[model samples]
Target: MADKVVPIKEQKLMDVKLGQLPSWLAARDYSAQGIFLGFKAGYDRFFNKYINVKNAGIGGFAMLMTGYVILSYTWSYSHLKTERIRKYH
Candidate 1:
């Protein structure tokens, strides 16, 4: 008789530990963790693809600064528009 190898997906599903917790809670936690990790992995892939500069630290800092500038501009623009409308009223 020959042994067949089980797929990793089945192996992982079989390895869930339901210690001191209800079956539904354990499954829900496992599913939520999986989704969070999957989203982080996808975001990391996209960031690495676009932000591959010479220095990793500098690249990260640049991205942070860019995001800050964008948010600042949007905030100031919205505030100014609201102030203009208030003055007219």
Candidate 2:
């Protein structure tokens, strides 16, 4: 029986054209301007649409309570003084 040799396909690297990117990403002001716009949009949506006075008050109170508990525990640990015992001959 004769054996048949099959050729393997070679992978090729694709060239990225500038036009392939979105208009915002392809613009020269993409880095800082785009990031600031995105951050502003997110901040606006979060504070305006999602957050309110009641939610902010509750969140702040919870955070304050947590901080107080942590501070109390740390203060107690930091105030404990070590005692040494001495033996007399």
Candidate 3:
């Protein structure tokens, strides 16, 4: 029979040891999925883990609002800077 494969997070929760604290924290998944989609992995994990069906009214709204404000400000600031440069040159 084939042995069951454990997920990284679940394996950490189930079998981590005090002596292996340093190594455990330093360990990373080097699988193709983890390596190729590192940024996407982290992004998906964060949204899946923290921004779920529950609290969509509170935390989700807050996160969306904050992201909107930040991106809008950044775009406006960059546009203004570019306009200033265009005026000079």
* Model 2 residue 1 lDDT score: 88
Local accuracy of candidate 3 as per-residue lDDT tens digits, 26-57: 67667888787877966787687667666555
TM-scores of the candidates in the order shown? 0.31, 0.28, 0.38
User: How do the residues 1-89 of candidate 2 rate in per-residue lDDT, one tens digit apiece?
Assistant: 88554222211113323454443244424579768986797667656643545555466457557879999877886454332243455
| Per-residue C-alpha lDDT of model 1 across residues 1-89, encoded as one tens digit per residue | 88676533433434544552345344443578788986797678757765665555666668768989999989799777877766542
* Ranking of all predicted structures according to TM-score, beginning with the best and ending with the worst: 3, 1, 2
For each candidate, the alpha-carbon lDDT, in order, equals 0.64, 0.53, 0.70
Screening candidate 2 with a backbone cut-off below 3 angstroms (N, C-alpha, C), the clashing residue pairs are none
For model 2, the local distance difference test gives: 0.53
After TM-score superposition, what is the CA distance of residue 3 in candidate 2 from its true location, in Å? 58
User: Which window of 10 residues has the lowest lDDT sum in candidate 1?
Assistant: 20-29
Candidate 3 global lDDT: 0.70
Give the distance in Å from residue 24's predicted Cα in candidate 1 to where it truly belongs: 30
**What's the C-alpha lDDT at position 28 in model 3?**
65
Name the regions of candidate 2 deviating beyond 4 angstroms: 1-29, 52-89
Off by over 4 Å in 3: 1-36, 80-89
lDDT rank order: 3, 1, 2
Better of 1 and 3 by lDDT: 3
Each candidate: RMSD: 9.9, 17.5, 7.7
Evaluate residue 49 in candidate 3 and report its C-alpha lDDT on the 0 to 100 scale. 66
**Count of residue pairs whose backbone atoms collide, per candidate:** 0, 0, 0
